[model samples]
Target: MKKKTFWIPIIVFIVTTSVLYLCGHLFNIESLKWFNFEETSNGGFTFGGSLNPIIFGFVIGFIAEWIYKSRNKNRTA
Candidate 1:
């Protein structure tokens, strides 16, 4: 697999998570949380939570790669 292709999901995930976090902070949405699994309370963001964004990014990337390869195989067959 190409290295660039492998990184697409990671980049996308980071961008997505960051945007969500910023939006939550800007809007002061207590329930809006990004990366961390824990929900916001009292209109404040938590420093630590159950979900890890990096791990989630990697998992999403792997799934994307798998699906792309599967489709390629079918197309070639």
Candidate 2:
């Protein structure tokens, strides 16, 4: 795959993560809690979560992009 094709997945990941964080902090929506798992310890804050859909989506996007590039490569050759 060309180097540029690899960026699509990365961009998706960043956008998804940012949206999750924004919704969690800015909107104060409890239903969106699954987006980020937050906690406090020793008077400090911690943040984390499974983000399963993001991971799954990225994996699928990467694979799809890979297959597309391969097919295009063969078509042009």
Evaluate model 2: give its lDDT. Answer: 0.64
TM-score of 2: 0.43
Writing each residue's lDDT as its tens digit, candidate 2 over 1-77 gives: 45667776676666765676567557776544454555677677666554654665567667767776888899999
TM-score of each: 0.46, 0.43
lDDT of each: 0.61, 0.64
Identify the leading candidate in terms of lDDT: 2
Candidate 1 structure lDDT? 0.61
Q: How many clashing pairs does model 1 include? A: 0
Q: Give the Å error, residue 68, model 1.
A: 0.6
TM-score of 1: 0.46
lDDT of 1 by residue, 1-77 (tens): 57756676667677755665666567765444443444477776656432444455557667776777788789889
